[model samples]
Target: MAHLKAVQGSKAPATPPSRPLGLPGLAALALLLAGLGWLAGMVSLVQAALLLVGSGLGVVLYHAAFGFTSGWRRMIVERRGRGLRAQMLLLAVAVVLFFPPLASGTLFGHPVQGFVSPIGVSVVAGAFMFGLGMQLGGGCASGTLFTAGGGNARMVITLVFFIIGSVLATIHFDWWMSLPALAPVSLPETMGSANGIFLSLALFGVIALATLWLEKRRHGSVEASGGVLPSDRSRWLRGPWPLLLGALALALLNFATLALAGRPWGITSAFALWGAKGAAMIGFDPGSWAYWQDAGRAASLKEGIDHDVTSVMNIGIVLGAMVAASLAGRFAPNFRIPLRSVAAAVIGGLLLGYGARIAFGCNIGAYFSGIASGSLHGWVWMVFAFAGNMLGVRLRPFFFRAPYRPAVKGC
Candidate 1:
């Protein structure tokens, strides 16, 4: 042993900077999670891994579906090095657990849910609408939470408007739900959960190929946009593939969450849940909230949205995201809000909460999960929401135009 004085005089060993676990750690975690899943009868390790993979896929799809400038994209780009990778890994683990291989080609005792409906007028219309709203709103349903965490006051405002839009749509839910025009819809008899996963994966591949082709074709076009990829990548990682893989992993994780949890991917319901609770707290009868008594409906509206598990899971998402941000040293004080904007956020929250209730989903529910689950209604919601988003974007400037506005300064 070294002498006490010599030991004291020696410089303290340089401590390694604590960092988020990378891929290897993720693998170990997955192994542990596999045991937990087996004991719980939730999923096999393979299935859980698939779910994690599904979420990984979502991250990529999300980038493609919405332009890169969106809030979620910004968050991912900003935190490219740290918690971002961890998040992707977590999602991959989740996907494998949620959507495991079936026994004798079946998920559950019966066939997996869903039907084969080709791209119809409805899907086209819905996709178009969803794209538009997502663009204008500055974030989608899931986008709302992530962006909110990132301190984008714009997203905060957009979320409120989203709630308002959702509520407006909900008031007519009974009528919309009963629409005969939405008929001629067919849930696939052959496409159980596993089959659907295969189909989605195939489609994802096609989309990926098309995107690549488009990128190559557009290389010289103005649409290609100089400085499109993050600057750090140009200096360090130096390619889109890493980002692409990272994103795909996210999408796969989402799928996994659906499989193991027996629920679709989503985040908006938390806002709705909080909204409903808030209403009840303020003497508003939740029963009169249209979808308040619609637990079953909401549950089906999006996989896992209405479940207690989903609620807790979303809480996990928030905590997880915050932790990720903190780990990356990206956490910061939130932006300030003008009084009217504050009022708008409150109003937006109410609208977004109620609207999500009426619409049966938010961005994730209506758009992301909807597209993944093959729901026509999800598509429709996206379209109208786009219109709503555009309407919102235009109107936002009017409601809260003062420069350098301060945030309301509280959660």
Candidate 2:
């Protein structure tokens, strides 16, 4: 996670020099509570709860600096495997938490389901594009939201273009869906729940082991896996949390999402919805688009953004990060951006938006939630997306002067 700033081409310190309870943090906390109260009253208690979950995720993401883009970049460029290994550990834990409930077809008496998408040419191509885009945009979907929320001006630019790109993709969504595809495949259903869980853990173990081997070969030793344990309880609130703890927290939260929402955690669908709504405001008839013609999608469009679960969660993520950044005394926004970097943001955002739409999700929805749900497409997404990252890392030289390197060695 130390490499997060580096991957974003930022010059800011990885950790703020001071931790203070700022006025901005207090305001953010108050606003969060007010929003929760409003949602509970106007929307539903479930929506309010989801907003709270998203806020928690934002805190964890910002404080821990857990990011997929930087993790993959570090592995690809520096051969540092700590971030990649942390991801594998996260997946392993999630698989354990998810499989049993999914197999039973319910959690706490509510029907629950995983993000099982079809494996197809669209998924392959879209995931690769998304991976490449995240590298250029300097953040993945969740990374963009949290960083933008934390006051990274360049990422805000990336986020705007991401919305635009997602809207554009809907125009061509029908064409993409026409590509060769298979029915959704769930590993638990195919291989049995226990067997599927075992296979997933084994794969995660193999990947973690491979990263350890590669990192040791390159650096002559493996990097330590997590942050130093907090010296005091206060440090836990104002943190640089241990990476493994962040991983575990994410797994548990995602499981909570499944239990509460009846589906796993997701991110980019909200982007598309936002874009479509904007288009409608501008007198563009997005409702006619093939993507919006689906019964569920059409219903969402009619319901307005407040009624959309993903949109509310997405909003909470931004607000939550704002609070965390304020608490860390790191919520300074610098708008000065290089011409090339801005250009990269525009292009990268478009790619990320478009790719996520066609691919069914981004790192969170597809790769993380997907694999955790024991879906075959999730594994396929990982392969293509990593390939995209390889190409994206090479393209960085065009926009960035040099890859930012921190004083700290490991991610």
Candidate 3:
């Protein structure tokens, strides 16, 4: 909660001025380029491109301060809907860009697919845990990467624990999968593509309108919808981008990912892979686990991190955030974390990693990509995750002595 408060309190300048780039930022940029070159040379060009795409995502996320955790928290605690509305807009735009291509089963001559997973007990329980973890951890998967890249020392701790939890979950993954689950349901497949797209858009509109009503009822007027773009060139280069712009950029980038990768964007799988690889190094046989017995999972486990798309993208996000933070002159890492906060990070990180594994993905993988892909499971994940967030907000006080104050910024 303190980390979230810090993020909310630090508003980017309205008219950002040109400033000297930090040494760290320069160094990060150099590293990013080198990473890309290595990937291009050692792996396929597509992998390298994916890294670049991930970096672009990190930049957009950091500049906009786009966050699913803070957005939901603000909506729950403060009756603010700006962040939630931006999310709705993001989903709506993604539906438009993705539906037709997914229906056709290809993008730009490449086979493509959406993130459609089963709706079941695992998703319900996992999403709920993920929601609670977001509050305690102060960030979601994407949020953790960008904030950690921006030099938040506490988040690094969360990331480490997150990896540990992910690996731990794999040990129990077989049992979770054995639980009751519905068949994967794709709206575009069940309904017609046009019909599914329309339905999804209508749902987004309804949510956005609901947020508008709630905000208006709670506070005499609703907050301004952040649809207008700033005219300043400097602001674009060093941003606090409008939430809508951030939303649009994210949607477009996701579409790019689908085109290039033949699948939707995802984040947490890399955590599991990293953990499994680490386990293997210490004489643990993750490859023998039922979760990794699958051909694809087994192959990824054996191959190095550089060959893993999610891993490369995850790294790109961190480096990209570092570059952005340095450019913004905000890459200051504070290591003086409270003991209680560290405890929260550990518990929250564990919950997040385990939850994401069981649930089939995190906010990005399950909720965002899932819903955009017209999967019924995505909707189920949202409802349960929101319920978890409600409880997580209540649990926040137990972890922190600081008085609860609403964040001023949208996610």
Q: Which segments of model 2 are wrong by more than 4 Å?
A: 1-19, 227-229, 404-411
lDDT tens per residue, model 2, 1-411: 332342344455555556676776788788889989999999899999999999989888887788788889899998988888889988999999999988889999999999999999999999999999988888898888888887788888999999999999999999999999999999888888999999999999999999989999999998886554654576576666777777888898898889889999999999999999999999999999999999999999988787888888898889898898787777777777789888989999999999999999999999999999999999999999999989999998898787743211221
How well is each residue in 109-188 modelled by candidate 1, as lDDT tens digits? 43433221233443433333333444334445555544443335555676656555544444555554443344423222
Task: Give Cα distance to truth, residue 164, candidate 3, Å.
Answer: 1.1
Off by over 4 Å in 1: 1-137, 151-172, 178-180, 184-187, 190-242, 288-290, 293-307, 338-359, 376-411
lDDT of 3 by residue, 119-154 (tens): 899999999998888888777888888888877777
Better of 1 and 2 by TM-score: 2
Residue 329 Cα positional deviation in candidate 2, in Å, after optimal superposition: 0.5
All candidates: CA RMSD (Å): 11.9, 2.4, 2.4
Give model 1's clash tally.
77
How accurate locally, in lDDT, is each candidate? 0.41, 0.85, 0.85
Clashes of each: 77, 0, 0
Q: What local lDDT score does residue 365 receive in model 1, on the 0 to 100 scale?
A: 58
- What's model 1's lDDT at 242? 32
Candidate 2 lDDT score at position 381:
94
